[model samples]
Target: MRLDKFLKVSRIIKRRALAKEVADQGRILINDRVAKSSTDVRVNDKIEIKFGNKTLIVRVERLMDTTKRDDAELMYSIIEEKYERDFKNE
Candidate 1:
């Protein structure tokens, strides 16, 4: 599956266009490398998404053209989440 479509079908980014936009901005990585919207995704692939100061990493478990809301979570498994804290305000 395409990276953008996988993000949407897995209910990660909510929309395909947004996924593409994020990918274009170089905020999404596949296997530790920057990935484009058309990048191919397969099982066991690691996807990392950068959201401002927070980052989310997930591993693709399976692929499907369509899935129910309840089954979306089964598509990928959250591996790690990290947040960059600003200490200047402290």
Candidate 2:
């Protein structure tokens, strides 16, 4: 599955357009390397998304064409989530 499509199907980014935009901006990484919107997503692959002040890491567990809301969480497992504190505003 494509990275953008998988992000949407897994409800990671909420929308396909947003996923593509994020990916294009180099905010998405596959296996520690920068990935494009059209990048291929495979099972067991690690995906890291850097958005806002948070960094999310997830492992691709499975892929499907369409998934229900309840099943979306099953597609990927959250590996780690780190929120960077913005001390500049303090």
Indicate which candidate wins on lDDT: 2
So what's the TM-score on candidate 1? 0.95
Best candidate, TM-score-wise?
2
The TM-scores, one per candidate, come to 0.95, 0.98
Q: Which lDDT tens digits does candidate 2 get at residues 1-90?
A: 999999999999999999999999999999999999999999999999999999999999999999999999999999999999999999
Candidate 1 residue lDDT tens string, 1-90? 899999999999999999999999999999999999999999999999999899999999999999999999999999999999989888
> Lowest-lDDT window of 10 residues in candidate 2?
11-20
| TM match of model 2 to true structure | 0.98
Candidate 1 has which clashing residue pairs, if any?
Answer: none
